[model samples]
Target: MSAAPALASLQALFARAVVAGEDEAVLAHLAGDPETARRRLGLYRRAILANQAGALRAAFPVVARLVGEGFFDEAARRYGEASPPARADLNRHGESFPAFLSGYPHAASMPWLADVARLEWAAHESLMAADEAPLDFDALARVEAAGQPCLRFRLHPSLRLVRSAWPVLAIWEANQPGRDGTPDREEGADDVLAWREAGRLRYALLAPREAAFVEALARGETLAEAAGEGEPWDFGTMLGRLAGAGLLCAFSRGAAAPP
Candidate 1:
């Protein structure tokens, strides 16, 4: 019999063993005494768990800090067992970590933990997003009033806006290094903005209205339409803010790329 099919079957079994976090099936495939094979697989499982947990720590620093190293490791292990890394790159792992935390029974008490995870993921993704050009003011100025509704503004790819019921920004900021003392732990709703500018990651907490306005623009709403979404949001002032923060990139008519 050809060995190709056997190899493929082994590969599938190995994946199941890893995902299910059980070693018996995979250990049986190894040519050794059952006890020795189990011991080796145990070591392999430990190493893989450590690696997966390490990635989660790097991606969600605040979450790890909040939960502490040991608890975080257990959580990461559980997450890995449920969802193994489908890709080789570790950076791509933990995309569902925020959602995992939200539903995790142990994390139920910390209602805002998931939002903090969201903030961390936003920061992580912003750093890796592709760079884009600054907003073209001239193009925006050229659009006629009649066509303003269709004139869509594009935010930079690296710009991420996170709206949360909890003050996640305050929690993240307090955990950051080099603070003079404990941060006030600012409470209440917030719209946290994260973006990479000049190779540095920038974060800010925005008011609800401003958040609404920016979110609308990010969704490809026209300048006129976006302005209407946020109560008391000043378009001219926001325009300057977008320019200063380097968040705006290009404009489009009906979501089509501008010429």
Candidate 2:
């Protein structure tokens, strides 16, 4: 075989060994006479495993604390092996971990664990989402009443809405530091909206109607149509809340005139 193909095959074999948790097999594949090659490969595997574990642990510190260090490490190792990082960005590494935990056998006992992870992931995503200018309240105030019907409101780039069957917000709060009271797993369902405001991640529980309105708008519904879908979707209340939370980015006074 050509040198290139031979080297590629060797690299693939090494990768498989690392992924399969077969360190001995990997050591055997290195140059038989060069003891240093086996040592170096082993070191490389250790470093890679450590890096992967650290990235996941950082993203899910609350989950790690909930599951205990040992259990969390084993679970993270298995997940890392199954779904190795495909991108260079470490911040995006644990995006699928919540879903994975939901189906994992060990986590089956903690039914709320997955939802907690999901909440944390949403917060993390909101913090990293693209930044945008806040809505121009002054300009909006100046728009004529005749142009109001044609106006289209825009949402902030950092805004995110998540609705969960479980009380994810309560679960998240229960896990937060300095929470003096006992954790209440049965706190109830939640509809949460998160966004980056003033360079900090901020979130609040949304009412059913408010959640519906925001979700509808996210799907490109005009304000009027979006409001129609929810309970009186009090435009004044929704706009005030969103604007206060920095969720409104910009808005156009009128829809694009037909070409």
The superposed Cα distance between candidate 1 and the true structure at residue 111, in angstroms, equals: 0.4
- lDDT digits (tens) for residues 194-221 of candidate 2: 8888889888888877888888766666
Clashing pairs in 2: none
Count clashing pairs, candidate 2. Answer: 0
RMSD of each: 2.9, 3.4
The most accurate candidate by lDDT is 1
Off by over 4 Å in 2: 1-5, 22-40, 146-150, 229-233, 253-259
lDDT of 1 by residue, 1-259 (tens): 2233478778877666655556666666667587877676667667888899999899998899888888899999889867778998999898999999999999999899999999999999999999888976887789888887677777888999899998887778888766532457666786998999998999887877778878988877777777784355467687678888888788777756454
lDDT of prediction 2: 0.76
lDDT of each: 0.82, 0.76
Global lDDT of model 1? 0.82
